[model samples]
Target: MTADRAAAPAVTAGRAPAGEDFGVYLVTDTELAERHGHGVLGVARAAVAAGVRIVQVRDKTASARDLLALTAAVAEAVGDRALVVVDDRLDVVLAARHAGHRVAGVHLGQSDVPAGVARAVLGPDAHVGLTANTTRHLVEVAAMPSGTVDLLGVGVVHPTSTKPDHPPALGVAGFARIAATTPVPCVGIGGVELADVGPLRDAGAAGIAVVSGICAAPDPGAAAAAFVAAWDGAGR
Candidate 1:
């Protein structure tokens, strides 16, 4: 049940069509999964079954080989059910793709390879997302050649322990301010939860990205379902 990468529709700045809801994005946390006695792939599969539309595999500590193996496993598990992306590791994404895994793209941070180089390597069809913590970052993204990137992962909406290096919490108001100015779809990450979905949507976020909210939960399936329910109820 691998996804047809060539046939997947593009996600522009505007809202996605119904059923292609990118409204609930899940970022995997290996540490969180370990704490809950679950493997990352298992949690991701359960989450996708419960309606998560996008899943980003982000493990800062795993070696390239381990990350590639994990990415491939996740691709097999949820490739048909959701968009499978790698976080901060374009090399892993490339390796996975070369290995015939159904990886959709990579989510890069400001310190990662520049978006232009990433786009050139990934080609036009691969989904490319970048993190933006300030208005300047958004402005830079907006100024990039059109189609250079697909979406913006705007963050630290609340203080999150998952990434100790995260910038200051943006809060909803700050998130709103940044989202309003971006021309691309934005997903609010860092400390987000089911309760924040509606307000995040109202603040112009195209989706909500969570780590512990689902991965650390006792029931990842139900947790992911709750997020989908909240997004659907938000009418975004």
Candidate 2:
């Protein structure tokens, strides 16, 4: 279907596996990963090994082919240990999956391709996330068929250069207010840090997506582990 035509879920309403953990999401930036003598794939592997539940491939500078290669390589490297999603690139997701990679799906923006079209294109088995902070954006997702969007990345929890264009920061209380209005799972993103994990989770965030907190770290694995530990111990 065209990106603009009215779209519907390709199948029934779906949710991620009950066992899936949205507690710690790692969004990779090749440049940040490279800052400490690491590559995106290498960082991704390290994070996943540390119990990171989701890894999203999001390198703004990478060409289509390069992104596809990295996504596939990450999927291969991550194996079934965690889910790998392409940030705002449904094309690379399709290509990587076409090449027999296990890309879970994509995370798109309000300005990127419409979430509905992406939902139709990728089907229900795929996990689709749309960046949303405003209640209006959450409403947009609520209007779609049950499975049209499986996840929502909802914040700029703090200011971060990784996504200079991020929406106004949605601190824990704000995020919780948004989370309260929707049943769909939401992961807080933007400049989230290790210390933000437990509070975000406690505030009702299904997870907190990290960029510099892990990618630019001297040790991404340890960084990821700390985040995971914080999430696991939240509210205890």
Candidate 3:
């Protein structure tokens, strides 16, 4: 079910409608879930119930077939509860959506397929999130056509083992600097945690994307709820 062979559907079946919050984004890690004894599906089900507005299915190690299956499972479990996006893989997003599973979009790194091309391919209704950490990168996104990107993930908010090669850590101030330069909603990602939510929200971040924070939590739902609580409290 590669992108090239998948039917060019309008992604109508399971795509989540717009207007959902991006706050408290959850990026899953299969190994982390395994270590925590709550498989990816379990964590996704619980986390969304606790207000994780966006769920990104990011299993770097999974095969294309496996990833597509994972996306379908997550989407089915989430239903209309949250947007389910594939991390760094446009093809799987397409394959899953083609199969009638509700997959919202894909999150791509700067080096992945250009966001503009992705936009052209997925059409206006799809939700796309791009990883851009610098002022220059964000400026590039700003210049693109409207709806080319729905969200911008900027970070490495604090050093963590998740992405060892992650660019220099972008503290709230650094993240704020980059975030201020982009018009699209900026989601602070990388090593984000529960405590970082308010400061990030205060720093102009629209949301915070976490991996291990929720995946490896003693209780995934509680951890997600805490992050949502912090973000909500910050606005008061």
User: RMSD per prediction, one decimal?
Assistant: 4.4, 7.2, 6.6
Candidate whose lDDT is highest: 1
- Give the candidate order by descending TM-score: 1, 3, 2
Indicate the residue-level lDDT of 231 in model 2. Answer: 80
- For model 2, state the Cα shift of residue 101 in Å: 0.6
Cα-lDDT of candidate 1: 0.84
Scanning candidate 2 in windows of ten residues, the lowest lDDT window is 1-10
Model 1 ranges with Cα > 4 A deviation: 1-21
lDDT of 1 by residue, 1-236 (tens): 11222354643312223332367889999999988987797799889888787889999999999999999999888886677899999999999989888898899999999999999998887888899989789878888999887778988999999999989999999999998887777889999977788899888887889999999999999999898888878872
lDDT measured at residue 73 in model 3 versus the true structure, 0 to 100? 97
Using all chains and alpha carbons, the TM-scores for the candidates as numbered come to: 0.91, 0.90, 0.91
Rank by lDDT, descending? 1, 3, 2
